[model samples]
Target: MDLLSIKDPRFLKDMNIEQLEKLSEEVRQFLIEKLSVTGGHIGPNLGVVELTIALHKVFTSPRDKIIWDVGHQSYVHKILTGRACEFDTLRQYKGLCGFPKRNESEHDVWETGHSSTSLSAAMGMAISRDLKNEKSYVLPVIGDGALTGGMALEALNHIGHEKKDMIVILNDNEMSIAPNVGALHNVLGQLRTAGKYNWVKDELEYLLKKIPAVGGKLASTAERVKDSLKYLFVSGMFFEELGFTYLGPVDGHNYEDLLENLHYAKKTSGPVLLHVITKKGKGYHPAESDKTGTWHGTGPYKIETGDFVKPKQAPPAWSSLVSETVRKLAREDDRIVAITPAMPVGSKLEGFASEFPDRMFDVGIAEQHATTVAAGIATQNMKPFLAIYSTFLQRAYDQVVHDICRQNLNVFIGIDRAGLVGADGETHQGVFDIAFLRHLPNLVLMMPKDENEGQHMVNTAVNYDDGPIALRFPRGNGYGVKMDEKLIQIPIGTWEVLKEGTDAVILTFGTTIPMCMEAAELLEKQGVSVRVVNARFIKPMDVEMLKSIFAEGLPILTVEEACLQGGFGSGVLEHAEEMGVYGHPIRRMGIPDRFIEHGNVDQLLEEIDLTSKAISEKITAMVPKKKQQRA
Candidate 1:
């Protein structure tokens, strides 16, 4: 149980099933205790204890690559590979990443936070190994939910066609954050439950092989017979048809079965698919029963009762406001539908799903599918609101351009977490949405200044039947601003001046607006009058407002909780030039062109000079220097 003494030579090679099981329990207990304080992906780690052990025993890591799909389930893998002591720092700044990071450990071959990437990465690794004549195995552990993604399917098709020597362990626990959906899940379920047929078929083959003279010759034909029997009995010929030698439905928790199947998979020459079923929360009681995704990614909790150590006074989440507004709108109109790509709970669409079961859809980590499907629904005269995290939406950029924007479909994209989503870090930051979404034609992109504006935008997007519209909102709580009972649809492509000043104009949108407002008040007290404008719509820039500011010959400052490059500021710069306004000094304030690290959101903002005090001081310094130059 003392994992630090894993310097013991026999840790992997000599451990029996009993010893391994005990170690698994120890690992689970350790994870629970540590995660209870730190708060991380406790459910996923608790599920894969035996499987990680089996994998290490069967294949030499750092040589034989193992790509963990999504990588949240790699906590057990991390523990076994000499990171047990650092588990307490999970998800903290400069600490262990919640997901598998290649930089953190040699055992982690590919870094991943997004889903359905493991197979493709594994295939590339396998082909490269073959090319280099390096005789090492390439194994990718993917889940049933990830399999639902189109990219995973595309990889499967390619891997099947190539018939490369690789092992894909399909971890089927009937869930990925939520209960697994679609026909593929049902097909896998049928295969996993075909034990009766397997038993009978194995007995018959044993009997056939026992006869003396014909036994040797018949053994050759027996494989074909076995394949046929599998097709007749089990429905998992779906994997075999993809050129993989299917091997499981084996108990992922059982050490002997897992090790045996893994050994078998390692020895196979062509593509192999081992189906291992595991519970999402194998050891923890409350997590085991969690059908919702509460335990998927969580904060610190009480280990004994599995109760989250919720903040004493929690803030009203923006996602909840989006969901509540959308639900109310849908209740009023049958044509309004809600869609998400495997993030119903994260986006707070569970309430909508409950009220309008058929209308609410979870496309299962298939961002591309969700986007196109929403486009398709829009074509049929239905308003499909896609509520997806900004980072995940990056996976469907092509679809947004080709399927929706090209056709000018009226789809409402509720872009949640469209800013610096701290703690989750680079792979999960929502800062690139404005840059990417702005370039697409026939697409309207905007961010709300507060929950009231978010709700208003939702209403505006619902009524407008022109082109694809997107409304982005940041993570966590609203600004606690009271909502308007009646939806006030502001004119599209107009900016509202919150505070009128003469020195310089600060144009901002989304989360940065409040910060700008704070800066404005500070500047007013300092005798440097500043103009504050909430440029709600990123696209279709308010020309009148820009013209007014140019007429005053005031310095312009643009701020957003998005990327600095080609974002709202770029739009302002481009417009200023187009309007023939010369030598207007402009300062663009936002996330720099670099990957942000994990930390608390407020700390990260301060680090990036996005805090109110930082912005106020910067503006004060800039204006005074400009006035001196004029003098």
Candidate 2:
């Protein structure tokens, strides 16, 4: 019953129900064994085994396009589509990606990483199918947690209104990294109860219809009554109201039920939504019991006990440091409040939530709502810290521009993971915050050089009464710098000169600052004196110091853990140009135009030529050959 050994594409088609069920168990076991070593999404994948099997059994993939929303739940899909052998390299550099990558396989219809994108992508695919007169089924497996995203809702409205022929499978595990919230979860709960009643009603109507013409009207009446009861008792008419044929609160784990529903949906769809109820970690005991969202996605762990293999080095994470600092700050100021869009654990706001329960808010998966809500709170003279990942914040771009920035609200935007987020890859990188946030008027943006500086930046954001201030930090631990207890406010728009040199100046912030310092040290050994400056603030340029550096006419090398174009270096170039210092050659260093793939942070940096060795070599060569000093 080893499913991994079944290599034939036609193997699933020939399998009987009992064999398929065995295959589901085998797939779960395979995932557990592989993931324990590689460290991938454990719980979400375990839940979708049967659902994925039923999907492949019912519809032909490639011909029938399947778009997986958020893509974390696509591990089962990957395994079923013959990528099981490649899964050992999950989330590693130059290996299999954690999310669905279009280049990896034809079975993966769309390249998706962030939530709520499936519906929109599926809608487009469905429309294309219709236009081309193609008979392919467009199935988008979107989770209940993802449905909370505004874009998903927007697509739902459009698809329903347009009457697009597509199937939206609502994989309701009732979680998205964190436990789901808001009215949507409640609606799914009510639908689940109503689906239970459907079985009894269906049997009763069948018995009533057996009596011919006299009982025909009675059965019809009963059916109408049952429909009325559905509206009154069950809450899933939300999808029905939106013009979708609401099918079930079907058992997602039940292979036959999944196959049946999927077959039905494939045949009769003019926008059908199958509300599939599933446990996140269905078969796996450890993942099923996980409440902290720890097992959602992770590094290699022991399969038996579900514990991570001890990471060789134990440095305090940047997230924990930020969380602790917020908890400490909030104890003194009641005006201080914490807000995250369903990422209390990811943002490390668990400590803040424990300490200030009333003040902390997890605003579901609606980043837009979280931002506007922060703006509303800030309007009332409260300092609200809106903590969210950089890529996910793209969802709330309009809200940040309209609600907060337009009004110049005093909301503290704690843009976490603000650079190349390693293994999660291109879709999840925190590289665009500087490009997006810096352009907006009345916004102050800064990134910390180390953990200690991060604490100071957080304090500065809270204390500043002027306008909205953002403190962006990277994904992992800081460089083991001693954290300060007292909340010290570093001056905004100031750059700290780490190493002064005559050859060139390397300005950087966040995780890249450490790498820049290393480059400076190496260059110094080669007798190339390089100046290293931590340009903390992106919005407000360090005009005085920049002018002094420009006046020196040294080759200015700007380094950041952000996108090279329209980032910190671009900001510096803009300032230099405005000050008529454009004649000086400026070399900008950071992530390139291409989407960075899954890898360790160091390897990723090296791949992009952002490493200390690369930087030192590039700068050493860039420094002019100065007449050889007449030896």
Candidate 3:
């Protein structure tokens, strides 16, 4: 059978282990070839090929819920669920999503992208099933790294306490984005090397039987000895103590082992934890050998040599610029420290970690903990720069509002990937940071127009001792702008006028600033002089500058690569209203109140009508014909 024609896993029900193994190989080859062109979570998908096959063979999907924790590893699940033929359009504009989409298939029971959510979602499904008097298994396949997340731990406590009949598959790959860290990771590590406990249990039971036929006290002592053996040999006893019927540290790649343990879990009553260990990036050589997590997710690469097809002479990545700047500042300032929520490589904090190992902390998959930790460090008069992606920051909203903003601590938040992140889609886009952060009092939120300004913003955030300051930088490479020899701190709430004109004023910042500039230049060709202002500061906005711009009575067009509601544009409107400045035709251009899907940055921007041509046309219409003639 053709791999592409494999619409569903119903075909696997009759196939033996040998046939399943062959199918797994075909699936892996398909993923490697498909993902090499489209680019995706290749490492995770590759690792789970066999495990996924085993799972589909045992359990019925759509009926028995299989919730993937982060959903990045759901590629194999997708392939088996009739999405194999749609691989060509994967992550492309208006095509198949990278993450699990509820609308995509009936098999995708729960949508996920952020880590540690599967347990809670599975619990909900279990409860719903129970309330409806339905009989179906609810299994959440969670990674070892994601197990450290506070929410996952919370869910574990609840699920154990509730004693619901559900199977929790702990996918112990020993990694999240980077290698797993902290105490929980250590616990899983101990479990991985503990070997099979069933053999030891059988041996102990036989030895205890040999000493039987001795009455009461002797029988009690034998029972105690059996219990003691569990503590000595079974690492899964930890989960047993949590009120869960713990299974094995099963070999995730072995079909026989997976099937056996899965069968055992099905037979067991109440909550059961099935621990399965597998290697991340299993089959592909480049991905398999990856120690630094570079191959976890990647772009187009050569299939033969396993080398990434490099684009011609790109500018410095935004992450590298911000993180490297932080590292540079940390050299002089002893108080400066860096923290990331499991993304050292993605955040480009590897240099900082290398330079200041003691000062850098990677609090694996715990965004809420990371935010508060930064706050705790700030209380001691030490500066902690919490580098986090914009989407993940949404998880730490309460911590930011209550701990950091309310306390007015001097914590520098480096908001990496601050706008449409492309390929990763709606779940990963950083569009909400501006709207979310701006609303919090005492939190200074800003973005830079270019990498040079980004360095200064980093300096500003570090230097600002008033309250919590956040610097948002977009994903991908910078504009290849010239750098300054000396770092200078720009004043808070200050706007820079990039190009001056009298017809209309274009207020924008960060990635949108380039678009505004280009639009302004194009408008100049059309005999319409447009002023472009870099409204970098989103919160505590440049009020004085805004007042001056409105005083000129020039039609104002505010643009941002963020949501229109409660965003930079809305901020401008609120200020205009507060100052009693009315009758000035103000137009706002930004992301609409809808989730933008996965695609390239250019495609996404164009889809949202955020291109230079769109901006120029809007600005031309906004400016009066009389004003155009004067210019």
Candidate 4:
């Protein structure tokens, strides 16, 4: 079987168990080799090789609608569905997506990057099928960790009440990035140890039948004893009580077990929860031994030794710079506490967690709860640093508005990955945070130009008792700039002037500052004086600086690596309009009003014309020829 040349999973249905086993081995090898060169969610895909094969065997996709929650594990499915040839360019610029894409193949019925969404999507599909009188199955494969999400639980409750004919595959690998926490994870743990329901059912029936002919009282006692067996043997009674017919904690790697349970689930009338137990990073040793979740997703690595390919020496990661700064502040301030929604590893809060074990909270995947909890913590006169990714913060907008902003509590929010996050693409990009957070009352939003500024901002956020303040930082490493010996609290609404000029001003912050500087340098060679201002404070918009610039009558160019609509540029425009300085020639450069796709960061920046070349060209055109000649 040529893995690369393979097309469609229809061929899988005809293959015997031995052939499928061989194919699974080949797939593990293929993923190990390819993903080593082109990095991806290798651990997850490797874990699901057999389960994905079994799924394709048991149900007909496209017609049977297999919706994957947080579709990172769908690489196996993609390969089976004729995408094996696209492995070399995985997660590269304009290459194979890390997650499922509807445009990539018809077999991808639903697209997903976030967790705990598949159940709702599957329910909708099931209802539509019922309405149209269609005969295909609707199966949503969710993970044990995602089951704890508030949305997932709400959908579960609704699906159970509706009792729709859908099969829910609970892929229990005891982890979601980090080891799962909260009450739901404990329930799944108990279910893992509990004996199979079928075995207990048969034994109970046999025991009941052995009872001699007895009176009503004796028969009632026997019936009571039989019913008690359900509680003793079946740990999934929780889901059963919710109206879903629960199936076994089947071995996900075993082909026979997976197929049998899947077939049974397909035949069942109402909703069924088929619990399939799997091992995360089942085949690969380095990924398998990952206790801290470092191997969950990775960059290119050495195949022979599993050593990650290094860039010789690199600056400290932005996440580390922020989290470490928070940890440092937390040592002095007893009120400072850290919280993350099940991303301690990604957020780089392991050190903080270890130091302040009692104060650090990894509240699972419940962003809504995390937000409200921070608000609650803030109400008690304690500072809560809610560290979350920019994209995930979108889920807790209501909480941010109603609970945090309305009350005007002092909550520090560290918005990590607050710009175009390359590789992960549109669904995971952090471009929308500024747009969403800037308009909220009693909230101050800012971004830092470098690691040193980031530290000061973190200090500023933790020490501020005024209202809720957020610091947005981009993905990957910082610029390795020199740090000051003592921390200083930066004044709110203050913007820094990095370069002095007379002809034009380029106002930007964070990752876009370097580009602005480079563009200004290029413009200097052509005799154009371009001023670069780090517009760190997004909301308050350095009004004094704006007035001075407007009085100087310098042409302005606003550059940001965020959405232009209702973003920092929009804020600048609003300020100008209010100040009656609308005559100044102003141009905004940023991500246009479109969802950016997955690609290299530099490539994506170039695509949107946010490069130094584009900025220099725009600024050169804006300034007058006489001004350049005078310089």
Q: Which lDDT tens digits does candidate 3 get at residues 232-315? A: 885546787788877778999999999999998899899999999988999899999898889989998988889998789999
lDDT-sorted candidate list, best first? 4, 3, 1, 2
Candidate 4 segments exceeding 4 Å error = 202-226
The TM-score, computed over Cα atoms with residue i paired to residue i, of candidate 3 is 0.97
Between candidates 2 and 3, the one scoring higher on lDDT is 3
Give the TM-score of each candidate.
0.95, 0.95, 0.97, 0.97
Q: What is the lDDT of candidate 4?
A: 0.92
Candidate 1 vs. true structure, TM-score: 0.95
lDDT by residue (tens digit), candidate 1, 1-631: 7875553223677778888888888988888888899888878888888898888877888788889999889888887788877876777777888888879877878988999999999999988998999999899999999999998999999999999999999998888888778889899989888764535676878876675656666677776776688778786579878888788679989887888778867777899999988988888888888989788878889987888897666657999998889899888899999999988999999899999999999988899999999999999999999999999999999999999999999999999988988778888999999899898999988888888888898898888799999989988888678889998776788889889988888999888888899999887777788889999989988988789888888888888888899999999999988999778778889998898888788888878888888788778766856553442
lDDT of prediction 3: 0.91
Instruction: Using lDDT as the measure, name the better of candidate 3 and candidate 4.
Output: 4
Q: Which stretches of candidate 1 lie over 4 Å from their true place?
A: 4-10, 196-224, 624-631
- Report the lDDT tens digits of candidate 4 across residue range 1-631: 8888878889987999999999999999999999999888988888889999999998898899999999999999999999999989899999999999999999999998999999999999999999999999998999988999999999999999999999999999998899889988988888888858855776788988888968889889988887677687855478988888788889999998998889888888999999999989888999988888888899999988899987878999999999999999889999999999999999999999999999999999999999999999999999999999999999999999999999999999999999999999989989999989999999999999999988999999998999999999999998889998799999999998999988999999989999899999999888988899999999878999999999998999999999999889888888899999878898899989999999999999988888999999999889998987864
User: Which candidate has the highest lDDT of all?
Assistant: 4
Please, what are the lDDT tens digits per residue for candidate 2 over residues 241-294? 898877787999888788887877777759999889899988888899888788
